[model samples]
Target: MMVMVLMIASYSVGSIKVEAAEELDLQAESAIIVDAKTGKVLYEKQSDLKLPPASMTKMMTEYLVLEAISEGKIDWDTTTQVGDYAYGISADPVFSGIGLIQDKDYTVRELYEGMAIISDNATTITLAELVAGSESEFVKMMNDKAEEMGLPEYKFVNSTGLSNEDLGENYPEGTEPNADNLLSARSAALLAYHLINDYPEVLDYSSTMMSELDDQPLQNLNWMLPWEDNNFVPFHFEGVDGLKTGWTQEAGYCFTGTAKQGDRRLITVVMKTDSKEERFNQTKKLMEYGFSQFETTELFEAGYQIQDESTLSVEKGKEEQVELETSEAMEAMVKTGEEDLYELTYEINENNLNENGALTAPVEAGQVVGEAVLQYKGDNDYGYIGGIGTEQRVDLVTTTGVEKSNWFMLTMGAIGNFFSNIFTTVSDAVKGLFS
Candidate 1:
């Protein structure tokens, strides 16, 4: 007789079943699925392997353009003049061009839409030039943003994914253009995650399966969109949205697909698949597995109580002890089906904490005073969570004529009392002798 054990995680919103011994069949050279909110890797297969990201590199380009618009350095409605450089870069056969006329003006918004929805190579280069003054400078900005996001595996050589040597027509002699862009599965997922969090408006274009620009119907390159006719890449999966797709003789096929199930959103990056259909199929399988197997659990609320233990001892104060607690509650999403529960350890800095340190002035309720580290010993490698420790200021006010007993006041009193007592004793002895 076979007995089946079912594990369920009950959350405030709903309950999710955590499947036991079930895993996703990720059929790609490299792949990763991450929680967009926490930057946690939910599932991974060769995630660190560096591979050509193909058109997914455009996500960063889109990010920089959107950032510039938000900064007021460029306006969506502002007209951008198409230059010889833009036209020259667009001529690459591998890239989708907007047929932008040289010296003709188009609003920054229109160019951005063309680059994002249509994946127009020319529009990307043109927008990069406008924002960074040149494609080279814009590439630098892309690399900078990647580093800022804590992604060290990414490198950008050009705004457009076209080969770097093809850029010589636009640049002068002795200038060698580098590879257009490169990223690992994890890094690409990070880029996509940043876009989703930073500029949700990007989905307005990425989610669009088809659009008409300049009398031409620009179809989305991402094949995850469900089509009425099942003839093309026939796999019906729900909740999938538009992202970028790429392929070359060297890069193979790559796709970054994002899907939403209720409030939970997952980003899946699959790199160097054998074919476009395989890439989408692999992504669909991974997404379905993620939704079916794991569920989110909110361990603690933002201001929930963390510790209610004995107060720490303080020196030279009216209050003998101070209450110790976290400004916020510790929360996490854990994989179900473990007999052994994970542990959250709180580490407070004894040095920064004053003797009998009651929260002092200028304290924010949720300010970090210490960190709560989480440790889990599951079949998967040990996992940890940090940054749950916090400090709040003590709202102590001095009463009239009553010396306020705080760290500052206590130190001053101790100094003054020692010197004043010594001087007074010396003067009294001298007065007695003179008398």
Candidate 2:
């Protein structure tokens, strides 16, 4: 049968399709957990609701900075003098600043470390200005990058996650002065997915639990991470690392956290939680569920062929049929013991067939003749993030070449069929007359 299929080439065996675990009933207003490698959403609660991101918005700023460095637009040692706008914000003890001096040239590396490790408001502004010449222009870049990355719901008003009102007349131009940066949980998880996949070096900064800035100690806002001398004790999970945290009277407590445990990395977001401690506690619930319930399972090996539909009929070829197999192995992160819920279906390329539904002779080995789609027979099949890619389906290819039949053999077969038909017709006529 002819069929259409969706492909998620960047994901493993398409999206994880298995029975939904007991609902987490996450406490946050919006929350989502995604597989970092495949961009699959393991769990979501009101994930599409747009809400103020608070300092979590800095993750985009961090992404833009790393992109600039990789593109040769800036270097770690490249320095820019702090402007009065940034210097003014640094002097405020309430906004989480490391105290920058006016017009002091600071390296990109230093500013980046401050912004990432501590969610320093002034350092974020400085880095944005350095990369885009002004915070207003940088805001434009942030919005542009969000669209480029296929983030479905997002709005960037400033490089820092702080509301524009807090900027005190320094907010980016062309934006409402009272507006706050907003993003949906799904989009935040997607941004984190792209950030780590595109610039993994970011973890080097976000993973730091403590850093020193000009003899002043700056602690990461993400308390789930381990400290220099020991784990954070009560909150620290074994693989807890990167990401960013945010808070404001308007945004409450928000966190975009990522962790890796034995080759499997997960990214979680919790927004509008009641308290700082609650955010981490909610994150721990999501992380524990993912690690304990799901596992990377190989559904099919490379060269796997369908049981009854292993070959396609060939017309005028030495061999009557051509064997087919999958192009590659199929793997997925499915609930343990629920792997059998997946079923494979394939559709042959009708364009490659003749009126008689047989392939033309001279079929080349490894030629893709059709597609094999993997379907999930389970509930709560949250699809892959970004909803783009070709990994969801496998290409069905020929296993060996099929040569055309020689003219002599073709002629002989036709002659034999003609006589056999004539003999059978006469015998049937005589039998009918006798009866």
Tens-place lDDT digits, model 2, residues 67-157: 9999999999998888889988999888858998875788998889999999898889999999999999999999999999999899999
Give RMSD to native, each candidate: 9.5, 5.8
Report the error of model 1 at residue 229, Å: 4.3
Task: List model 1 lDDT by residue over 1-435, tens digit each.
Answer: 111111122223333456542356567898887766565666778877887676687899999988988898888888877778778666655455757776678888778777777678788888888998887788778888988876748777777665566566564222355454678888888788889899888888887776775676777766767766665546546777757777765668888888887777788888999987898898888787767765566454333333443234444555444443434444444555442344444555444455444434333323444544444445664121111221211211111111236777778978899999999999999999999
Q: What is the alpha-carbon lDDT for the whole of candidate 1? A: 0.66
Question: Clash totals for all models, in order?
Answer: 8, 5
Give the number of the best model, judged by lDDT: 2
Task: Compute the lDDT of residue 312 as modeled in candidate 2.
Answer: 86
